[model samples]
Target: MTATRRAAILIGVFFLLTEIGAIAARLLYAPVLTIPGYVLGSGRDPLVYTGVLFEVLLVIAVVGTAVAAYPVLARHNRAVALAYVTARILEAAIITLGTLSLLTVLMLRQQPHAEPGALETVADALLALQDGTLLFGPGLALGIGSILLASLMYTSRLVPRGIAVLGLAGGAVITLSTVAVIFGLYGQFSAIGLVVALPVFVWEISLALWLIFKGFNTAALERMPRRSVDAAGAEVAS
Candidate 1:
């Protein structure tokens, strides 16, 4: 297989890994999410640790997707590709900070005679940080990066135009929804927010599966300017 195709598949794999981590964390953290005191309770150590593990995996996956896709995207537009990579890196960093907060909560819980009120306050703050990261990292950064990358794909025909359109639209909707939530129009995880985010979720997963199973469209690749590809590669390397 071509190197570019392999990279595409790796991106899909990493994307899938990221989703898995998110799902697993949600399931494991369900009981603890709302109950600030739950972090100190008995028999929850494994759950907390496992959830943190998944979150670490998430960090890895987020960065991996961007790094893997950089070359292919750079082939079409070097500046946009670099921006995408930067966005993804920022996303990963924000999420990593969130993960560290969770770990801090865990450490606090381990201390003997820890103050319940202090634990609760710290936990609440950390959760708020996580929520903010979701809004800033995935909601804003991911949306913007997806739009740029999807546009490149559409213009270059790297993927089907339909998928590209879905991505562009989904990204815009999510970004807008994020703004509404920030303005207090609704909660972050509210029904309206989920509805708007559904498209981007679908677009990413569909794009992932397509890349894994079908790879890029060679016809489209041929149609792209050779000069553009070479220039982008040089830019990335530099």
Candidate 2:
């Protein structure tokens, strides 16, 4: 296999692994958190630790996927590749913030003997930060990044336009939902956001599977840009 093709395959595998890890972590999280609360009166520490570990793993998986995919993207289109990298970095930052926010919330919840005024205010602020991070940060980054990456992939002939369209729609939903949350429209619209996000997650997982199992047709990859150049040259000569 060509180096580029090999890189693409590896990147595809990483993407698949990341998604699988995320799904697994999500599945395990509630059960683990509840166990501490149900069994022991003070499962708070265990739950928080588990949550932190899960978030750390999630961050690693995301970063690893981005690094693995970098070569393929760099080969196809530099601008798009940079954008992809930037988006992933932004995503990492969002996740980090989210993790920290959650940790803060956990700390506040686990406080043993409460203070009077200042500590209470600090805890309230932390809680607000947690809410803000959860409500907006990751979703915005993920949605915008997905749309940008999908557009690049479609334009570069790396994927189907339909996928790009779906990604674009998902980005729109995410952005709108975030706005709604900021504006205090969190009742019915938040549910709609969840509904919209489910298909997007499915689409991404399917795309990752296709990329890993089938790989891209290298022949098509080679022909696309060359044909574009040849056509352009012909126009110039005419």
Candidate 3:
């Protein structure tokens, strides 16, 4: 297969892995939370630790998928590829820190026989960590990254304009919802965030399928206008 075909296949695999990872994390959330509660018999420590593990894996998968997309993006649009890559890397960092904060909360909860004051202190620390990392960091990074990727794809014509627009909208919703979550806004908005995320998920899956099964339309690329040559010259050049 050609280089473009190879890149397309890889892109498809990346998205498929990402989708699976998202589902896995969602499924694990309940189990992870129940573990701490089951162990402590009275507290929610097990649940917290399980959440930490879930978040960590989620971050890893997201980061990995983003990284995998870089080569394909480079082949499609070199000018915007670096920006997309950078945004994804930064987003990954934010998730990593957020996961660490969650882990910290879990560790604090693991104190087998602590005083009330100690437990209170730990709770306070956990709250602070959650606010700083989970509440703000990952949300902001992912939001901005998603927007950048959307814009890049749109401008580069790497994918359908409508899909790119959907991506941008989805990113905005996620970012705004994160802010709302932090500010203690209506609880229903959280569900709205998930609703907004659906379009993005669909677009990614469609892109993956197109790449893996259909590959790129080489004839279309060949027919596309070339800035370096006039129509007549371009035809001859080809």
Q: List lDDT for all candidates, in order.
A: 0.81, 0.62, 0.61
Please state the error at residue 126 of candidate 2 in Å.
2.7
| Candidate structures ordered by TM-score, highest first | 1, 2, 3
* Model 3, span 137-221: residue lDDT tens: 4456666667777776666566667767877887777778777776777452267656755766776677678768976556544
Count clashes in each candidate, considering only residues at least 3 apart in sequence or on different chains: 0, 0, 4
Best model number under lDDT: 1
Model 2 spans > 4 angstroms off: 17-44, 107-124, 187-189, 223-238
Residues 26-74, model 2: lDDT tens digits: 5544433334222212336564566567767767766766677665555
For model 1, the superposed segments whose C-alpha errors exceed 4 Å read 42-44, 225-238
Off by over 4 Å in 3: 31-56, 75-79, 120-124, 131-138, 180-189, 217-238
Pairs that collide in candidate 3 are 33-47, 36-45, 36-46, 36-47
lDDT of candidate model 2 versus the reference? 0.62
Ranking by lDDT: 1, 2, 3
TM-score head-to-head 2 vs 3, winner: 2
